[model samples]
Target: MHPSLTIRRENGDMVKDMPRVKLALVIDDSRVVRKVARRILEDLDFEVAEAGDGAEGLAWCRTEMPDAVLLDWNMPVMDGLEFLQRLRQEPGGDAPRVVFCSVENDLDRVRSALDAGADEYIMKPFDGDIVASKLTLAGVL
Candidate 1:
């Protein structure tokens, strides 16, 4: 049985009870980045969604808001900062914890993202441990 599932007996048969699955969105222009983040989030028991840019991400959120977001700082169509701003304006948008994942490590840039309503920041080339730690701190784990 998966860690997220509970095994039980029902009428002499085994049943797997699944707990409420958390949803996570990975918004980045890079397909590789999205795939990597999705793997980590899935391993953490979250159902993951992907969007190529901030515009697409926001559109997805409007339809089905996620519990957490892994956003890229830079992308065409709309940047992470703009998406964060717009997302906050949407109903139930404030509920998702947003984490900016990017290659930018400048202090000022980090501050700007935090000010724009990002819950945390993760430098790119991130591994599972780094992502897990950041998500845990952001109260998503």
Candidate 2:
């Protein structure tokens, strides 16, 4: 089952009624992957949005600043690495915590993503727990 949207402060106090919902953007070419990510983020109390590829993802960021981004490593238009490079240069883009979800688990690719500005990286076949944990680490959950 999924969790509720109730928010608790760092001090361990529960926030009052109608806590502000966090926004999360899922950028992946696979529809299934995007759906999975969206479900997880929504369960974590986030208002989720999605993009089919890096280009659309980049465009999405132009309007709203999501609290977090679930990015894929490979896509049709602009790949995750390229998007990461370009995103970091955009205004307010640095604020959103980016979590790269890709099959590229190799050390060099992982290093490159981190070096390019991805805050976190997750290999393929991830569960809700893994996603939530990464968000927690990113201070998004």
Candidate 3:
């Protein structure tokens, strides 16, 4: 299931009329990860959207034009690298800042994500405060 659907069902009221809160899209395969991310962003007053994989994530990006994107590196469909490439190619694509959230800790992978246009990177098992700090540094928070 898409994380957005779950979030909409669970926190529908909080999702409404939040214009001051910037829009963000969280793309990951794990529901637990999405829940944690949602909790953190909502606490910070971000209007959050979510997707289960990179393909869905890319689609959402095109349609919603979110202010920022939290993307997982590994997914069953259209992994993060491809999605990032496609996103950068879209018209007015440079508006949304992207941050990679993944378990892959390899320095090379981190470099690749940055080269692919990720403004920042966060490893898995992340603390909410740490993620928030990174987002702030990336100018998303």
Candidate 4:
């Protein structure tokens, strides 16, 4: 589910007057990569979800409805490009801005990702500033 920022009362009801947190998903095979991305997004004030692969990420997208996604290019089960293709076809999928984050710096690959519906692209070895910048450009931050 999309992560919540609501305050709960003593009886477990939501406390009024607080704004909901925006959700972001980090999809990559590497645990280290996911962890790094999660930390960056969280620092940007986003509630982050992580997936080990494209397939799992897509499954989460079909349900949770996050505000943004940081997707990797190479992964098991489903690659990032294939996942992007499938995600665009799913209901409400187009609503979340997708940022393709990978080591693949080839222009053609980047173009393909944009053509397939990615809102932005980030080269790997990205820092928190880069993540925040891309998310901002994509209107996710």
Off by over 4 Å in 3: 1-9, 12-18
Off by over 4 Å in 2: 1-19
Better of 2 and 3 by TM-score: 3
**TM-score of model 3 (CA atoms):** 0.87
- Per-residue accuracy of model 1 over 1-141 as CA lDDT, tens digit each: 124533222135543445666778899999989888888888898877789999999998987788899999889999999999999999998999999999999989999999999999998889999999999999989
Per-residue lDDT tens digits for candidate 3, residues 10-108, read 535544333344777889999999989988887887768889998898888766677788889889978988888899998867788898999999999
Clashes of each: 0, 0, 0, 0
Question: CA shift at 28, candidate 2, in angstroms?
Answer: 0.3
- Pairwise TM-score winner, candidates 1 and 3: 3
Model 4: runs farther than 4 Å from truth?
1-18
Tell me the tens digit of each residue's lDDT in model 2 across 1-141: 113444443356765454567878899999999888888887888877788998899998887777899999889999998888888899987988999999988989999898889899899889999998998887777
Estimate candidate 1's RMSD in Å: 7.1
lDDT of each: 0.87, 0.84, 0.82, 0.86
Name every residue pair that clashes in candidate 4.
none
TM-scores of the candidates are 0.86, 0.85, 0.87, 0.87
TM-score of 1: 0.86
Compose the digit string of candidate 4's lDDT tens values, residues 36-117. 8878887898867788889999998876787899999999999999988999898888899999999999999899999999
Rate residue 55 of model 2 by lDDT: 89
| TM-score top scorer | 3
